[model samples]
Target: MNLFTKYLHSVTLSLSKGIQKIACLLLLSIPLFTQAEDGYKLWLRYDKITDKAQQSYYAPRLKTVYADLSDPSVKVAADELQLAVKSLLGFTPVVKAAGTGSQGLTLTIDPKTEGINEEGFSVSTTPKGIHIKARSGAGVLYGVFNLLKNIQTGADPNVTSSPEIQRRLLNHWDNHNGTIERGYAGMSLWKWYELPERIDPRYIDYARANASIGINGTVLNNVNASARFLTHEYLGKVKALADAFRPYGIRVYLSVNFAAPRILGKLKDADPLNPEVQKWWADKTKEIYDLIPDFGGYLVKANSEGEPGPMDYGRTHADGANMLAAAVKPYNGIIMWRAFVYAPDPKGDRFKAAYEEFKPFDGKFADNVILQVKNGPIDFMPREPVSPLFSAMEKTPVSLEFQVTQEYLGWATHWVYLAPMFEEVLKTDTHVKGSGSTLSGILKGDTFGYKMTAMAGVANTGSDRNWTGHPMTQANWYTLGRLAWDTRLTSESIADEWIRQTLTRNNAAVETIRKSMMKTREIYVNYTSPFGLHHVMGEGHHFGPEPWLDKAARPDWTAVYYHRVDSTGIGFNRTATGSNALAQYPGGLVEVYQDEATCPEPFLLWFHHVRWDRPMKSGLSFWNDFVKHFYEGARQVQDLQAEWQSVKAQVPPEIFNNVEARLQTQYKEAVWWRDACVLYFQTHSKMPVPAPYKAPERTLEEVKKLVDIYHIR
Candidate 1:
């Protein structure tokens, strides 16, 4: 009986061991079968290199990492390199303290690196090994990410980067109730109910992504702010997030309500001149610094869009901003006072409001205060001339505030690459000091010679797994960060880099994607608001086309108010004969904009109202040219769809299918815009659809019904 029992135990154990070995073998092969890529990792996917030559070259060079282990940021940089090397090269790199050996990649702090600023980095391939040096630990982390990005794109591991703007930030319009103002991605990323107790791991990932892109700060709440964010309860929550982001070099900021003293502190008044109000802000600033020592200061949206400001107390914007600036000055914090104001005067051009208001008090702002101006005079339209305030404010330090979110460019549904739009505005000549006085130069303190410089993007990020709603839209966010870091980068180069890292490394696919991205913004402008017609979107929601919209609470908020269409002609006359808003610009720009014959066609209708039968530079009559732009714009979308489809085999199936679906939706919407605008404008122009372009099957009334559905809000 003992011999049989022993034999049975030996047989069972042998079979169990064999099964375990087979299971482990199968588990090892899982990566080969998993080809579906859901784009949760936005541009930081460190998948193994497909090119054998690149793998061979990078694998040996990154075999070890040498960095100082004393700093937390340096440790993070080393760990990130180890993890990236393991995933991309399929081998973990040995990370050791600096001076261990020079054979491997070395991370060093070099204060004398030329062109490398405080948070700037320089990387080079040396005879000893790869060398990465920066002035700070944050710079070291950025260098590591840049090195990995170079490896992924098969580029030379040599780069020197310094941010053009001092405080590059993402301004989140996320609310405490988990809703975003103009966000189309999803709900807010910050989980207020569980924060300060149960921090989500996503917070760390977010900070890591921002650091990699050279974004140093984030405003955690909507600018249409709530006073509750200043309370102790929310400050504790914000402090927890600050701690999570601090390791990755991201400072946290809050959008404070101007009436917080009255609302949160229960003060009788919120006047900037009041001593009690001044003391309250100082105390609040001290409280914030105590909780989060490295806290970035407030972003204010006072006296605009129903928000209360010092104007309510018979004071100026400078009076308000300087008060807050003085409060945080001891703590070395700054105030980003928004210059997005527009008055309710129906006769005055809204385009001239901000310039007139801010230009008067340019040098009155405190040293710690920066005037954050939008890229365009109007809102973030598809196309508009650069703000006149940029040139007029010589003594003020104005920062460029760009909207990375696609609010007017068909929010999340259409594929409009905004880098090109940003490039257009940045390259626009202010002509104040001379022809070379570009918006980029102004923001960099080269033109105005102001102290501080900053660039802020209204972020499009949300709780979507892809970060941005459309996977391709992630490029917009990436582009903003890249441009903020180095304004000299071309839109075309940014597109190429983004496509290689985020979508495909295949050369053919990258070229095809790059071309499409370059033209997407113009296509959007042509279809939606061709010839400088701005803010012609559906009232309230701003979703579908509503060129016929005339009724609204404010005249400036309506489409007809902007387009100013009548039986005789179309376009707003901002020239000498009309509102004379073109005079707001410098004399050189004013001359170009005042004349119909000399003005650029893109901005022709913005400044002058011409006859429908008047001849255009395009050789077509005004009405015919307008119709052609609308038709050609929609037609270009079809071409873009075909171009995208040509690279189907080159892209990952998940991304290919996702983008294809959006492209289809984009084409449909493009046609909708063309048909709606053409039909509505025809009521005034009384022109036919012209040769080759067929008339829309649906009437203007039919399209109005569709607009009604979209304007439920």
Candidate 2:
């Protein structure tokens, strides 16, 4: 075996022995779990260069990488390489002088120095043995992450990669108080006050994680932002974060409260057209740039959900976006204007809301402005059809914003792997530019051929010592990064990589988890929200079932609005009889959705109301199939729990215990979901429960009471 392999085996053996000794006395009653460090370490699990076999890896080649270190980004990349190499490869890589005389595994940045494309990287091992080149320091850092990934995945470290897109960012729905808006992973990791001064050591590891995954930017707060982040006091703190992230090639952006010019500054009104307001914003932007020269620009949630906007000031959405775009123009920054607006009226189609608000000003946005559209029109629900906005505005640059945090997909408690969901959306044909015009193709600027492009994910990271709360949930983050870099990659490939890196390189173990993960999203959909029955969660906190809830201020916020379950049957009538939102898509897709027969079965409930006795493609009556789905879903969870059991011997006891504990919860929740959903829907179907599926243990009132107790937390 290679030295790295031998070193890892030795360390693992000693570690396992230590654990065995600790648990020896208690062995009869309990199995000790694996070390907590296994999870906190994430996928960057590197080992020492023990045996002489892998000398070529460490030796003189990685001994010293010569970098001029002229640029801050360059210096950051070099320092990160040194740290990762030491911790993982068991050798501290030294940095020598840049350019002219550097030798062996040399990382070269600076266009004038190497002339590589701004987003491209090259790593070649020749007779002389090592040369790593990138267009910029950011590119070099990406290269380092790629190299670390190879070591972790057991791939040849000698390779080259060039990012297809210019920017890959993570959007945090984190508020000033540390509560992630829809976060299930504890509170936000960013302790705003302690920043710049206190510098939580977690910041470095956070940087390391993002750098390894090629995520180059972060918007620190929620789109529904608080004005406090704009003040001079907070800017200092933000600057400290910027400094910390510099080396990792991750730029920091602030989600601006649209009223900042008036609230933070003394402007009379934050009007996009007002001269003083414009000047106020420009000055603030300049100040932000001064502190963080690479400040990535503003992400705005204006005129949406009560957030102040250009509309409040008697201007259009484009006027609002373009105003900020103008402010950051001098600094080469861009604006991410959100297209998630709606007036919250039940009468209007919420599906058509974003398109209506954004379409009129499609070509009006400044070149630097990008409309950040969610994967679907509504909040991230399971199995949503691709957003209609993809084809609505052909002119503006659009960045696909997805949620990796599982806001609607059972949060951190349920084991729902989401790579399949991502792959499904990425491969969706928008038909914007014609046949095969995938969302990925469109966002890359090739479909409409625009310049700036990006893909963002609402971050799942928090203060959890495990990074993501559940051990397996880390796969979601891993999938997002890989897909952002290359939209065409399958969820299986990404999960496989994460499996090998985070858990084990043992092919059997990897294959088992990979199979489980690949089927996770589908299994979740089958049990919880089959056929697109969404927003059924108990109101606030979105925990458990509450399809009976309909008295909320807005219909969109109520469960009944989305599912439309009533005595006659279930599902919303989004066809021509209902919202007719299908008209928003291009001709071909509109036709498919308009006709009940052609509409995909997965979305059958989303578009049409059907009778309980209706026949389905699955060769069962609708009620039989529906009842079976609930039972099948619960069984899948139970089966998964069983599957997780068989592999206990293959994993560290700590990790095994952590996941096993979650699977227990998952099993209970799955039953809760199945029982409650089938019981309630059976009342609407006016049909008896399937022969195999027994009636729920309790009444609807009891289920509602349970929901109340569940969400009250």
TM-score of each: 0.95, 0.91
| Residue range with the least summed lDDT across 10 consecutive positions in model 2 | 25-34
Once fitted onto the true fold, the runs of candidate 1 whose alpha carbons sit more than 4 angstroms away are 1-35, 112-114
Error of 1 at 438 (Å): 1.0
lDDT of all predictions: 0.89, 0.81
List, residue by residue over 1-713, the lDDT tens digit for candidate 2: 55654454455556567775655434434423435554887877665444464555546667777776876666777777787678766778778777534346677775753434575677766544467678787777777667667665666777666666667889998888888888887899999868778889888888888877878899999998999999999999999999998878889999999998889887889999999989999999999999999999999999987899999968999888988999999999999999989988877768789988888887999999999999987778888888988877788889999998877887888888888998999898877766788888888878888799999999888878888898889988888888887787788889988887788767788888889888788888888888777778777677776677888868788887788777777877877788888778887777667777777888888788876777889889888998888889888988888878877877767788889998888878888888888878777777888787778888877876786576454
Q: In model 2, what lDDT does residue 491 have?
A: 85
TM-score of the candidate numbered 2?
Answer: 0.91
- Return the lDDT, model 1, position 176: 95
- Report the lDDT tens digits of candidate 1 across residue range 174-254: 999999999999999999999899999888888878988889999999999999999999999999999998878899999
